[model samples]
Target: MKKRSWFAVLSLALVVALVFTVAAGCSKPSKQPTIDKIKKRGVLKVGVKADVLGFGFMNPATKQYEGLEVDIAKRIAKDLLGDSKKVEFTAVTGKTRMGVLDNGEIDMVIATFTITEDRKKLVDFSPVYHVDGIQFLVKKDSGITGLKDTDKKTIGVAKGSDTQDRLAEQAAKLNIKPQFASFETYPEILAALQSGRVQVFATDGSVLKYYESQDKNTVILPDKYSSEEYGVATKKGNDDLRDFVAKVINNMVSSGDLAALKRTWGLGK
Candidate 1:
């Protein structure tokens, strides 16, 4: 009976030891930093605009994304994954960009997103990579040369952008009240303007230039409303990624690479 009991005790000890060995081997590693996660995945996911020509646009002919923002995302991917082509693009508008970043659909957003105090509450922003001003795109025949002539006129803007607020603030200074019509995308706003549904389409000057290029009938007003500082946005609490993005932007600015990129896309001015 003693011998049998000894054997049973030895077997139970071995079983517990084997279970512990397997558990240790199967335990997950500690949480990985965002950069490491990207490296492991072998691709960086970026949210960008598909319609803004100079910044982020999908070439209809090539059916591929290209623009200043797309290049920047590729550069980041190269830094993180050792291959610029290891980046995936997800077309995003002002309204959907933040949602995708928040839901983990993309690692970051380089979608001509303006940095603002209110937005800083939800997502961390890298340093300003580009600065543009609000402007109006009006039909050549509309006779609207500037904000002074926009009183009581309807201006179209993107639904989630700050362009409307900027216009309101500027118009208040001029004692004018222009009606606003918001749309999901810049193309829709331009369409509304073409249909005479809205007399003006207001957005960043760089973006307005693209629409003006597409339609010779449209002209961007010379009056600059407000300066918008564009930044790369990362999920809130992802300081590591944000800092790395900031470093890349700072390097670009210092090396004149950002300006060169702008010139490549016809946004030099």
Candidate 2:
């Protein structure tokens, strides 16, 4: 009886050891961060502009976001999430773009955000998808051909845009005092110009073209204000996500999709 009891005790110990060994070998560590989470969520949260005309804007008639930037976001969603319609548009402005990205409110920003060194410190930018220059829009009859002509006239600019700073620097060079009136968005600036509240509105040439298409009475002056490049903005440290986005943009650029979209939106030659 003693021998049998000892044999049973040894058998139980062997079983417990085997079970632990198997558990340890089979256990998996937690998953690392991946684009898979975004795919699983079934939505690509894209930050965009709601009133930037050709780049990103909402069509009230259809209640859908449409434009070059919107198309780019849709392509990214289709590539990463397998559905072009899986994008949720979050309207963003220059002042709020970085804050919204840092707060994780959106996965990426496809707004017409200019890539600058200061901005690069806060977010990662995909490859330059579009190259443009700042320009001015004035009444077709304003007789203002360039900033040089606006010696003492009022100029409308968005509060947080690079245009505001560029205009200031240009005014200093010209030794002119510009009546600087700030608005929250490009549309607001455009409204101010159309209403004769401001003599000029400064922004990217592509954006000016968009506004001109909507209202033929407006004209973009044949003057280059400042050079700028537009790119996709992702939170800093997301190297994987940033690379993925960059790859998509590069592919689009090579495959003629970018050019096609630009032409479709009346932004290309």
| RMSD in order of candidates | 13.0, 15.7
lDDT of 1 by residue, 1-269 (tens): 99999999999999999999978854544366888888788889999999988789999999999999999999988877789999999999999998888767899999989999999998999899889999989999999999899899999999899999988998899999999999998889989999999999999998888899889998888988888999999987677899999999899999999999999998886
Worst 10 residues of 1 by lDDT: 23-32
Per-candidate total of colliding backbone pairs: 0, 0
Cα displacement (angstroms), candidate 1, residue 259, comes to 1.9
How displaced is residue 111 in candidate 2, in Å? 0.8
Give per-residue CA lDDT, model 2, range 185-261, as digits (tens). Answer: 77788789989999998888877776777678888888887889999999876777899999999999999999999
How well does model 1 score by local distance difference test? 0.91
Model 2 CA lDDT for position 100: 82
